[model samples]
Target: MQTAASKAPAFRAASMALPVGILTLITLMVLPIPAVMLDVFFVLNIALSVAVLMAAMNAMKPLDFSSFPSVLLFATLLRLALNVASTRVVLVSGHEGAGAAGDVIESFGQFLVGGNFAVGIFVFVILLIINMIVITKGAGRVSEVSARFTLDALPGKQMAIDSDIAAGLMTSDEAKARRAEVATEADFYGAMDGASKFVKGDAIAALLILAVNIIAGFCLGMISHGLTAAEAAESYITLAVGDALVAQVPALLLSIAAAVIVTRVTDKSDLAGHIGGQFSDPRSWMPVAVVMGALGMIPAMPQSVFLPAAAIAGYLAWHLKKRAAQPEPVAEAPPVSPDRITMEDVSDRTLITIEMGYGLVHLVDKAKGAPLVARITGVRRQLSQTFGFIVPQFRVRDSLDIDANAYRVLLGGVHIGGATIRNARVLAIDIGDVREGHAIEGEPTFDPSFGCPALWIEESERDHATAEGFLTVDPSTVIATHLDQLLSRRPDALLGPEEVRALLDTVKEDSPGLIEAIHPDPLSLSKLTRVLRALLADGISLAHPLPVLSSLALALQQTQDFEALIDRVRIDMGGWIVGKICPYGEVLPVVTLDARLESAILQGMRDPATGQPIIEPDLAGMIGERLARISADLAQRDTPANTPALVVQPPARRALNALVRARAPDCVVMALAELPTSQAVEVIAVIGAEEEQAEPQNARQEELAA
Candidate 1:
């Protein structure tokens, strides 16, 4: 047997009723409709207008009737088309009598206006003013403002969606649905802003049509049909006024509907229900009841009308007050069963986690295709290759305790770094010479990743900022870049015992004998991890584990100290390090310490009992200042082989590297023994030498350095 599901295809075809109706409306505009048909069409127009108004009243939200804008346009067109058909019949045969246009128009003109053409004309003009100036104008302004604010709030809405996904409050599909809803709302408001113009235009067109019918019909009756001026005026004026009233009434209904749709706030109840619920308060009704009762007792008032209304209001107030005094009933809960709990139910803490505020949730919402998840995956892979071990998976969640635009990164459950971003705006980083007099208008901020000066500008200004030599990035990219910087600096802490064992297990597959000979013999896995961590901390890549393992094997035979092992490995990996810093086979431009400074550093490093290099605080501060200056100057220069380097004696190289790592992390510190003999070196500048102490000394040193 055929069921509802099987008949769905036939039912679907019935959905085309609206399109068919619209086509009929257009046909009525061109073809001459019979008087009877015109009457039917006029009634249908009134019915349609009432239906639209009722729908607007019942709608829970603006988006619930997303097609209201299109429907309004079509309804206006239908009304105007009917007016055209009625006007044609009236002008061609209006001299016959008041009923020339149709029975519907004749009835409205005679019965509603008491057969007075002047009264009907006055009423039509009043309706036009109300629709054009009051309802349509106000609704249009509301739509315009709503559209602008909705577009402006789009970025914040999207960020909130992402923040929810990151916090595990919503799945990817749920987030996608919310994003689609936001876009649909913006589109609906924009269309409504334009559709409201149709109502205003229709009202103006009705007035113009009214004037044409009355003036033209009067002249045609007297001149062509041989009727007297009084007779023509009586017949034509009545019909013209009737036709205008028939169209204006329906037009007024549609205008009210449009106004209602635009102005209605999202609510769960219909218009009557909303009003009723809000008026449920006893305090509001008691004052209204007392005022009505006093008005009924006044001498001039109608006793029947005021007295009954006062009685009803007073009863309503008493009923509402009694209802308010009653206490609400509480729901009962089911009894809980006793059960045993164990430690197995809880999981261990994650190695790394990122917590974001509510506004930033959209960054990981899979529904919106947030790029942060993919970016984090890429970071893990890249860091894994650089640090010679797998980076642990990062956990992301939302925190209500933080600000909406803020996010924080944690390493082993400890807060590391984070920053706030304008999710609704793009960040434009100033890469060029951004001086004090620059005229760009925006919110001044700083780039979270690199601490560069930047501006948070509207998305519309992205192109202009790019043209002005600024790097523009979205909110997701800003967060990802900041995460990358944090992970790079803390790779040592990320490398725990589990990560070391995982790396060794993979390495054993290709070189089982090498792993067996080195591990647990002279070098333990724990000691090996420490040595690898030291190399990674200095910005060296261990993508290939073979060379590192081979160097360790030999170094372990002679010495077991991690510092000594790292220094020996650095000398063996010099070629690899050089290739990373400069082009292959290019001359290396380096800065060298003055002979006097090198001797003083060597003297400080000779004491092994201290376990770290010891120098006077003033001298150490001076050395750091000089190194930072040289590094910054080289970074700004336009040269092919100008990678900054500080070459020191072998004994003091490790000690000085540790001192400058925090102050000038970008400067590569090299021991004289680590430089390949085959590669040529140029002394670009000397730091802390006797040259700056004398006027002639500066000139002599420059000549010697070149």
Candidate 2:
């Protein structure tokens, strides 16, 4: 089966590869190199321009994909018309050259500034501008254009063009700008980092050699060739296979550089960010074209193989770089907010800081205890040191730190948390005073929403808490205050006892072990009961199990009902254990009942009819209580009875057998007659003729035997 993750990259790669392949194949086959070089370059020009148009479309406040098809079709038709015009001019000039080289040259000169070719270029430029207007007026509709191309053609790649970029796209500078965009976005350096490890330092050495060889190739062509600089540059390609080996240097560099940049950009920003940022600006990218163009000026390289090719490379690198830098203005605006700002009105150096906390760590020790660790974000990275935690924590792809503190922390647009001066630390003084830093310096401390003023605690040499100085905070106040705040936020007027009980029941189903482990003590139980009652007053019902277990245990302690409490707990736990061990649920009920009986025997039971407590009688209570106590000894919850060892008083089985077998009535039987008439009658129903009930009670007998 194909997983969702694995399918993503493949989709993205295919999208980009298709367009490049289509245009490159067409340009290579039919068009002669000299005549059609610029036209071929235009295909790349179109792709870059489209990316900018895409950026602007993205700027719209809300992103929707309704009008993608119409926009793409319009853009494609305009581009195709320009391609045909450019192609005809080149073809006509070639035929005109059939008369003579001079005639062909003249024809080319005429086509450069006027006539059919010039008219076609003019139409193409108009079409490009019109496309931009449509994008702007349509609101966010332009994004759909690029999106359609990507979804229908390129999977992961995103194209965005804003007004500024769309304007630039019509200009001749588009190609040059794109090259620079590609260079900046490229990540060959990172790939070199990974690739270096496999070969150790060998990859670095190879790159250095390649760079040297390229420069040397230029030098050799300059020094040895008798031809003029440009002609000699062309002759350089005529060298032996060994010289060809030197030509491979530039090829290797191009491949490695391209791979590195593509991989890094794809990994970090995806094709969208990489392309958007670089293509957004053109001026910053001019230097890369200068470098490639200068390199191409080296003598002795084949014109047939290198001149136009080098120029094309230069154009591409420049185009990509510029496009990535410039972002298109979206036709639509983001939803209105107090913090919103218009793009054109903003200065380049203006810095906006947003305060927040992001990374959340849930730590589980022994698989049963859950503790939480959250880092305050958007502060100085160095602040992490003072707080005694690692910096730059990342899980998945999101950095945990809040980007800014000024924005505050909003849960559903209501402020729930904020960082104070005390929670922050100064990392770099030279970076200038931040608002938070200013607060920190003036007050010496400020507490965050979730924190109180810092308390004095001795630091241990080791990182973890030690037994000697562990903090034992009374959780009642903390729990109560937080609970009250939580309930107040709810729309309901109040919670009720039954609702509280239902919440406990839900918790029991999902986290049975957690509920068992949190059994409250007497004081905690009383507080919890009050909290529940408060919830009831407020009209919310929540009778949580932790409080109930604690209350029941406390009541048992006072009423001498400890044995019954223990028995009920045994019966409850037996069902869970049997369910875990048995694949089939059939035998689980029987297992549960037997556990209850065993508990009853060991804990001992009193007959209410006689108003007397029986010990080690013909009944199973003696042994059952002993077993229940033994089971309690093996318990793992927070309850105190879960000791590692216990002493079980053996039941008097001989007396029990005699009581069932004897025809004479014993004093124990006569004692039942002294009870109230109603209770006495019920006792008779309960302790029926032992011999008659023996067959059905055999399983009960076995539990007592334990």
Candidate 3:
């Protein structure tokens, strides 16, 4: 069963059809075929042409027949090759009789024109005219125009799909499908423009082949076969005309098929149904009936034919009019009740929402280009790349309850931050370098993102503010930066089990064994989510989950105690966490608790439920205050580290983390076990040591070196 399933698609009919068809077409052009085989091919050619025509008519839209161009190419080749084959036999066998080529051609030559060579010539010329001058030419022109217009509109169609995605009206999968469809439509029309040339050239080839057959057969019959003018004309001319007609009929059918394909307007119904539906309208047939009846009354017109057509038209109009007069079944207007409440009405599905007042609505409006919305989209994309998962879509909506110029960011229905904006005004933030009382006239305010002193300046004063050593930004940038500042610190608040599951599914595709070792076995989803959240709060990003999970998987081999599991993962990942802040080829500027101070904090208080250490209130306050001051000093002085990290024993890292983050959030906390020995450190500050208990300056230097 398994072998059969694996081998099924290896031997498909479509896989062999193209090669077999091409070989047959080549054989017809080069090799001589018997009359029986020639008859079979002729019937097949007629059948194939009719199939193409029916396929074109049945297509509901142009894209549904996207393969028409290639199909037309193959069909045109087959017919021309058949022409080459039939021409070979006719010139060689014309002196024998009408039956020399095959019955298909013999019947066409003898029966189609009643064995009259002149009538067959006239009939063949008429088909050439219709196929070349009418159908092929018109279809080519339509294809060229369609290709030009489609190429012109390509950029706009792509932009519209992107806009829908940014506006949150379409999902990623839906956008991909829409983009593929637009590209396919363009390619199809361009191919048709080229393919129409094949049909036109085929028609010309048919006419030239006919002329060659008649002239060559005439000369050969009289000179070589000892036949007279009347006998030669009867034998050769009839066969030449018959061969032309046989190929011409299919060529005409294909020309009509190409025209049908190019001219079709996209509709819900196929060609037959669309045309029938349009004629079913009573108003259109009423005019038709009147015109037919008027023509039938004229004596010069054929009364027998025109009168019945007029009567048939009248009956169609009357029947359509009666159907139109019958009232459609009414649905009783659905009882005019109040709209029933659904879960979507009251519950907010959006994980993050930007609710603004009426005045700030223009910031998110689509017609004005939605500057704020675009920025928000960029922020979402950047964060998703940073965090290695798609951040949920943010919803921007207007509310009457807030101040007209204010907009607020929400996470899971909880207010994160709200700030007021001065519409049309730019905020020039003072980055602590502006000289005292430099004269720049504007309204004074604090920059909402970081509380830096800023001025809401008019657009004209932008250069003046820049000259005064202030960084300038528009209203949209202010909101986006503020949102980034607030959200970048709270990644765990944004991550959930759904996001973790998505990450797991992604990693499973690349490294399945790593996931199977840790997930749904030692750690269920709920437990795994808790562990990841703790890692995120401890300053580890899931952006590169492979390394993080790789460390976790190794740790699971030792122990599954929840707290022990977290600590082991952190210790394994510590060198990475510290490398992010400290510039390369320089010592990491470190702060640590004095050995005695850490001992006191470790032994002070414990949570009764979890048995984890809690910090003494007074000591926690002193540590936060000292770390905050050291962080400020580090910012001004030259240092390898961007921020000071508090390194303590493993037991006290979490308690000190909450404490240091409260006052100086930029400062990172790490355990002594977490830091790698290869990374040299400079002990810049040490918390809680007396003049006597503290180690000497030289001793402290040696302590950091060790």
Task: Estimate every model's Cα lDDT from 0 to 1.
Answer: 0.84, 0.34, 0.88
The C-alpha local distance difference test score for the whole of candidate 2 amounts to 0.34
TM-score of each: 0.48, 0.19, 0.54
Span of 10 residues, lowest total lDDT, candidate 3? 692-701
List ranges where model 1 is wrong by over 4 Å.
1-348, 433-439, 605-610, 692-706
Q: Which portions of model 2 show Cα errors greater than 4 Å?
A: 1-66, 97-706
Q: How many clashes (backbone atoms < 3 Å, residues ≥3 apart in a chain or on different chains) does model 2 have? A: 98
For model 3, the stretches where C-alpha displacement exceeds 4 angstroms are 1-336, 691-706
TM-score of 1: 0.48
TM-score, prediction 3: 0.54
Clash pairs for candidate 1? 162-361, 162-362, 163-361, 163-362
Best-to-worst ranking by TM-score = 3, 1, 2
lDDT of 1 by residue, 316-369 (tens): 889998998999878787564457454644643788889999998998999989
Better of 1 and 3 by TM-score: 3
Clashes counted in candidate 1 amount to 4
RMSD of 3: 18.1
**Candidate number achieving the greatest TM-score relative to the actual structure:** 3
Instruction: For candidate 3, give the lDDT of residue 543.
Output: 88
